[model samples]
Target: MDARASAIAVRDESCVGDEFAPDIPGLKARRFWIRNSGCVIAAALLVTLSSTALLEPLSDVAPPTGPEQKKPVVLARTRRQSVTSPKKARLWMPRTGRPETLDLVERMGDGSMSQTSYFDISLDLNENASGSAASSASAVAQVADTGANPFDLVLQDALDARQLMRHSGLGYAADAPKAVRPADQSNVTVTPAQEAMLVRRIVSLPVQPERLRDIKGVIGVSEQDFAQLASGLGGDVVRKGEQLDLIIGQRPAQPNLSEILFARHLAADGRERLLARCDDGHFQLVTDHRPYDRMVAEALAHQAAEARSGSAQAVPKDVAALQDAAADYPKLIEHLARRNVPVKVSLQIVQLLRANGIHWSKTADVPQLDFVFRTAEQGEQELVSVTLKGKGRDRRFYRYVSDSGKPEFFDDAGRSVSKTLMHKPVSAGQLGDGFGWRVHPILRTRKFHNGVDYRAPMGSPIVAAGDGVVVKIDSETGYGKYIRIQHDGGYTTTYAHIEGTPKGLRVGDHVAQGQVIAYVGSTGLSTGPHLYYELRVGDTYKDPTKAEMPAGTTLRGRALEEFRQQIGRVETIASTIRATATSAAHSAVSALTPGSDKQ
Candidate 1:
């Protein structure tokens, strides 16, 4: 035995001897001796085991004194076996939250309510998830059991779904049972040409959600997988024939097709993704849909490239094509019409399209063809309209059309036409801070703060104070994200703590007056969400609140007169909106009145 165990045994022996000789309680002393003897034996065995691997030998020679150590075993949940029956299985897709739990009672052979049970495969979104990775791993592990499927399926991100498939080693089923077709079947039709068109249209769309210009190849995901996805997507997506349509219900008349294409791209794996360039010179994601079109376009481009390298002559153009030689008359007459297009714009449009073979066609009682000539002015713009009359080879037509001293476009789509030169500043409320103020929040002391702060939310629109060139856009550093625009007369304006800058505006990019360049944010050294606006003249910071800055835009002459004429229409619409709102309020009150509807 080790020294410590020997010492403990000797001490216990001495204590037992003393208790027997001097203590009156002999029975209690005998009990203590028995307990000490057991402890000594246990300690000796533990020490022997610690010094050498003799526990196995000891167990063989003697016996175990206590229960043995063990690993807790977990058993998989067993599913009760049922006799096979001719019953159709229908999948129920749950909403964003869990559906009411329905207990299974019995099953009837028919699809009626005579006897049935529904196991609601409801989802609990706010359920205490075991975290993303752990839940994914556990879900994948469940597939290994051969007795029965633990889960029907898990709806997750495309990456997670793919990972689950890989770990689970489940083969994708291309063909699956589909919902029964409508009895009428009047609206459904399958056409080879239409299929080709649909594929072409999908592939031609851009890969990026914002700019659907990338033309990647197409991929054919399994039909079963796609059906499941369609079910999960709810009614937001419409599946007609082989095409999936994602419609933004807000704009029902002109539903955006590109957004739907982007949604599909996001759901697909990177391995099957198609790559293409958008019109804005950015890379976009796409899918492999039309192999033939892509192959043809690639081949043609390659051949053209090879020909160029081999010093080939000019590329071919259609020899049978004809040009319109009598196209300049209407354009020239349209140029002379100052009443319709602004005189300056009319002249410029005529000058640009002077010798070009522009065609004119007549429709109903009004002229339809118009040409807009870009001008050198910062914000001023113009267009020329020409009446036309032509049908075939011998037909000819010519006339001039103009607006006749009326304002052509509303300055703001959200606001009514302005009656005065001074339209209300883009947003309402009041200025909270003067420019070049020195203040501290925590210490309550003075420190030179560069900009004036405007109280607003994180996503409030920040409009351009004037037409200007964006000289700086900082996406990093102490300012967080900011935009500095250099306006006319060497004046510069800066807006800081922006949620996001305008889509394409960068350094040297021009911005029109009143255009939204950024949204307010609390990104930088800010106490709360607000816009830190600064106006600078040359290198000197000016007090924006006190400074009488020149107005950036003005309505003049006929434009002003037209604006004045629009006041009555604007007021009438405003009044109508107010009346409608009041009527709605009154109806709501009446409906809520005690025993009104119930009575």
Candidate 2:
């Protein structure tokens, strides 16, 4: 088709629906009316009401008195009263005014005075007002002399002044009107009890600066007095830049006797006593004395038995002394233990006393004995040290951290007490299979087993045999889900047939000994739920039950030398404590044993 013919055809098709389209202008006009018709009607009604209001006031005016005199229209009026009715009137006056006579006058309808009666009025001033009686009386007298109403004078003064000024002050003349002072400006005398109550109320108030500022404005106290009040309430007033800050310190409550006793029982030095103040205003040592009392009773019974047995013969002085020492030995040992001496050290001390033939009465003659066990923190590390004064010298032990980052306790000879690996890692389980040739439970064939099995209920916890880093964590064909850990001394351990490992456990993560890493399961080629554990030394399997494990790390060189120095420091502290205890013991023994000579 030709270009012009094609354009004409397209235009005809586009105009097919034009005749059926709604009128846009008509729709728009309807919408505009719907949205704003109410506003237009309201505006017209307001204008009409305003015009009626403006014309109504003109009705009250009388019409012009020309040939026709028109009456004035009254919009509203009250009902008339009877002429014989009597009305009572009240007149108000200032409370500060003295007694004075007032004339009550009545006027008739024609505006002429008819009757006049005299009445006396007297008023008293408000007690809460800052204006003194003298100032109030003077103000009233001045108003009377000026022939002005005292009520108006007092009302004007109250409205014009912000604060009530003191009339007796030298700054103002006696006759001149003084500045008014507010009622709150009067000096307030607070007792100690009231001050304490106010302190409590102030502490509970909000600590915001705006809140505190409002309180200060209302209280009208000087900054110095406020500071003194805060100090008495166990608070500090600090000036921060231009702002003042109050810091209230709450005193820590003293622990009760029961709480104190619980703490002492759990403390390292259980023998420590507390000097507590009693309600009767005296101090007494608080300690568990039941154990000491039992020991003393046992000693007394033994002494009496020995004396009765020797009644039949004349006992020699040496024999009697030996019996006395024997009777006191048990009591003395208990006393040493109560003083925080170690059992081993106490035994050595008793042997020393026996060899020297020293009676309990002569305990002060024995060599000064010292023993200490303490945990101390140095920098970021915590160390436990023990010192024993025995066998004529002091022996020490220390828990030191090794190069492998494991802590081990070492004695004076540098020997460690902890073992390298645990024989059994799990708490509750039975040994199922040992490392050797064993018949496979599922396959029904003999196979060389590389590990041992611990039969346990499903989901039983499996712990690490030693402190090590996890080297492997993945599923295997026959082992199923398993984890292998690499320990020191060329040793490695494996835990197989685990249902699942703990969350967040991954390869290269360090695990401590006895830490639960996984749970037991019957995965892979197994019969039931069990833990397959293996121990290897450089790829060679070892029977955990038969093979001798490595001992804990030993201290050498500088480590050993430092341990000896720690022992000396502990001994020094122990010696000071022992000397004090010995003096107290000497006094106690003298009191218990009548006629015993003091050493």
Best by TM-score: 2
lDDT of 2 by residue, 1-599 (tens): 68797566444533444355345664445445544675788899999989877887787454365898766655454433323324333222222222111111222235433222111111111112323333333333332234332111111122111111111111112224344357633444333321110110011111122222233332333344444333332333212111221211111232111110100011123334323223542334557443232222222222223223432221244223322333445344323322222233333334334422334343232333322232111112122443444346654455556554666556667655444566666667799888999988888899988988888999989888876788999888789889998875468888888899999999989777778999998888778888888889996999875665543444568877766764553343333333323332333333233233222
Where model 1 places Cα greater than 4 Å from the true spot, the runs are 1-430, 442-445, 476-478, 551-599
My TM-score estimates for the predictions, one after another, are: 0.23, 0.31
Best by lDDT: 2
Taking all chains together, the TM-score of candidate 1 against the true structure is 0.23
**Clashes in each model (backbone N, CA, C under 3 Å)?**
14, 8
Residue 559, candidate 1: C-alpha displacement in angstroms: 20
**Which runs in model 2 stand beyond 4 Å of their true positions?**
1-371, 374-396, 400-416, 443-445, 546-599
Backbone clash total for model 2 is 8
